[model samples]
Target: MIKKAPVGEIPFAIAGDSRIYVTAFVNGSDSLRFLVDTGASSIVLNTNSPKLKGLIHNGELADNLGTSGENSVEYSNDNSVKVGTIQYDKAGCAHIPYPPEYWDGVFGLNGLAAFNIEINYDDFKIYCYPKETLTVEDSYVSLPFTYKYDVPFVHLHIKLNGTLHNLLLEVDTGSDRIIDLNTPFVNKNNLLETKKPFAISRIASSDGGSGELKNVFFDEVIVGPYIMPKVAGAFSTLIFGMQSKENIDGMIGNNFLKRFNMLIDFNADKLYLQPNNFYYTPFYDFLVR
Candidate 1:
């Protein structure tokens, strides 16, 4: 028996530096808070979560594949993912050793790919509709995206030190920083040897892994037809994690994304952005002492 999941709206709360958390039901368990993360490949349950304890019954032991260093994890098809009344039967969940601090688990894009997901930052609500019912407002700008390793990747250009650099970046709604350039991309571009100075900051990944990166300022970042100036960016120096991948350049996080109302249509492989009240707000540079 298939339950109806035509349309629905999930309200989320912003906590701990623009992280979006929503309520979800997992494996017939009670409702628990889960972060709405487009960066995550699949539904990841925290082992430390009180409500999610012992949820990985049929999971198989495997290496935890994250941008960060590898650890052990359990991947199981014995679970189900649910948001409000919308249930995902085919969706599988993973149990990671490192748990999230603020939420019960992380809600990845695996199941969310079934709909046209819209996030209204101004209203703190996630509205989902059938892909066939997608309607784009005149105010929205559309950009095409491709799925790479279960996440959405988009092409954009950045101008730094009077040079134009075209790169492919991931739309990572889960991260709070503005931009994080991968290690290989930074090395290839000779960013560390630049005349401009940068600050060093220690960072942690979603799976409780730790790494370090250099924080720097960006002159201008061009996304689609939008030009954002004076943005904060990072040069990842981590030995492992998503930041070390050679195939991609970087990722755009919430600090850059909160400026717009966004929509992600997985079926059409399109991303839409519209300017909101938060667009003009000054960027918060955490690296600044």
Candidate 2:
């Protein structure tokens, strides 16, 4: 017999750039705003975060690679972390460099692995159900994914230069832009030759790095059963320097995902996409906003 799982609902607020944030209590003391980042592997706390007060530091060190470069970070263990009615004891966390204004930390997939998390972008709420008891609706399109270094990767078919190319993309909810391509994929496919001159723009990386990216209109981008036509993407070398065991082709960010109400089950290796009311909404250049 399968065990029944508990259900929890947490309210989330949208940042100016459309990033989702939730307030979580650390060690039953300080409450901090943590970005709900699916792209991140582990829970990351800013070194300057006030919530770091009572956590015990562990001697393990890790390197976090971003658009700028790599930063060496340390790990810590907290007695308990409370998110809504759910509590995790002896939670492992990464202590990284100071985050930007209005952001204290990142709540990643490792922190939410026990539950099947549903991100209701339309309602600004997060519904979490125990993985065993969670039931996916028939309207949802289930996409298969593989986890590497605690990050989720999915295969997407995108039409570039009238040829359909299968690309492996990271589902990055923490990113504001629609699509960010890596250098190898861009060079191998000769994407620059077909770029739109008028749509080129400079983009700022999340780690305070900056690079040039050109927007290209694709004939179609198919994610699971959904088809997005005339999709816009930013081709850049921003992620070329990042260290990864897998050869990642690019990333799929919030601008492309916001149109759907998503459910990500990391433990089960499944992503469910249900098109919301804004499914057909026009895509804007959020990087410039």
Candidate 3:
């Protein structure tokens, strides 16, 4: 139920380098910030936000499995969420520790499943339209996506030591990482024995999930027609819930996603991309100076 989506554009801000979020009125009481994430299942309000006052809430916040590790969330019904030109009546959100520090929660892309969403990094705007309103073309590298639990994923080509292979990666806007290879996938490929890892780093989450990542380099990564050479890669230890899941190889995070102007057509189950100003910029490495 996309209650009142009125075709419009909303501006957003990037928090701590990679998380994209927007401020919205929560139950007409307070203006709260929420990270717009496709990987999120639904709206999850920050249980820590002081603004939680005035919003009718009564439930237990439960911990759930996540990429950084364990995550906690509580379900709530009959809420109102208004941001930009969209208003969601009878909104359902969860109470979770997300975005960290002083931010609110995550506004899941599943909430806007009825619209075609466009994200422009150049202007920092998110445009929403009624389904079937926007047009697509062959010029745009149209990548088809499959959904799992409301999150969208696509296959990417990874070249390791002259051998090219395909891996299904979750297009996760919620993560700051560029690429994180899951344990099973890494084990299946025997990457640890074959590749030289340059560094080991710890990745943390707001819900207290943290683990070490072994850093390596992919000889080449193909995103549509664009080729990224010597891309930084993280092989997960699989401590996190999502990382331990089988079948999927890994996730492509916001650091890589920000390089393109994207349009996600939920109706068509497709993601269209064009390189933005940040495309040629270097990928974030695991090293800290």
lDDT of 2 by residue, 1-289 (tens): 0124337777888666767889887765677888888777777777666666545355488766664355667777654677777788888787765644646778877777768788888877777777753456666787788875457888889987789989888888877778777777887778787777447766554344566777877788987777888888877755434322238777888878888888887667878888886687667645247
TM-score of model 3 (CA atoms) = 0.89
Residue lDDT tens for model 3, 100-183: 465776788646675788888888888887887356676778889998645888988999879898989999887888888888
Give the Å error, residue 12, model 1: 0.6
Candidate 2: 10-residue stretch with minimal lDDT? 237-246
lDDT of 1 by residue, 1-289 (tens): 0023438777888765867888998887888988878888878887778887766466787656466666667878767778865778857787765554567888888767777888888888787778663556655788889877678998878887789888889988788777888899899889887735456767777656778878788778886678988677888887787788899898888878888888887778888888887888766634443
Model 2 alpha-carbon miss at residue 263, Å: 1.4
Residue 126 of candidate 3: its Cα lDDT? 84
Question: What is the lDDT, from 0 to 100, of the residue 154 in candidate 2?
Answer: 86
Error of model 1, residue 238, in angstroms = 1.4
Question: What is the model-wide C-alpha lDDT for candidate 3?
Answer: 0.77
Local distance difference test scores for all models: 0.77, 0.72, 0.77
Query: Where does candidate 1 stray beyond 4 Å?
Result: 1-6, 133-138, 195-198, 285-289
Model 3 per-residue lDDT at 55: 68
Task: Name the lDDT of candidate 2.
Answer: 0.72
